[model samples]
Target: MDFKTVSTIGLESSPVAQALAGLRANEARYFWNKYKHEFVTEPAANNPAIVARVNTILGERDTHFETAPLEVSDFEVAGVR
Candidate 1:
């Protein structure tokens, strides 16, 4: 299929797309603790409690990101809102 058609294909109904989507998610969080966890912290040197809260939010977002539905429209690279 062409790139335009492929880009719009609904992932939920396509096994190939779904598997690819899942693989991307797995790769994204392969080192979630190492890469993503750090970004949760703000620029300011906050207290220990604030740091902990940031970690908690990052953990939760990672969890939900994997379990969420595979929607091609939701992931449109250029037009994502």
Candidate 2:
């Protein structure tokens, strides 16, 4: 399978950004091999609607991440959102 290269442009603030990117790449490879799905990420700032939707979803549990979300993965896996 051909793996798509992932970008770490927005993850600069994280201390282990490169490692995180590598881990994401590994996840992409795994998903591609197992489900033939391509994992993609978008800069959070570029997609406010997605971010707001995520916040609303998280509100159901009264749990929210305090750190700024630099990027987000917005996709369905096998028809599950």
Q: What TM-score fits each model?
A: 0.25, 0.74
Write model 1 residue lDDT over 1-81, tens digit each, in one string: 121122323344545765655554554443343444211112123354554554577788874333334331111223432
Off by more than 4 A, model 2: 1-7
Candidate 2: tens digits of C-alpha lDDT, residues 10-60: 688998888777778888898889888977778888898899998999999
| Best TM-score among the predictions, by candidate number | 2
- Once fitted onto the true fold, the runs of candidate 1 whose alpha carbons sit more than 4 angstroms away are 1-15, 37-81
lDDT of each: 0.39, 0.79
Model 2 TM-score on a 0 to 1 scale: 0.74
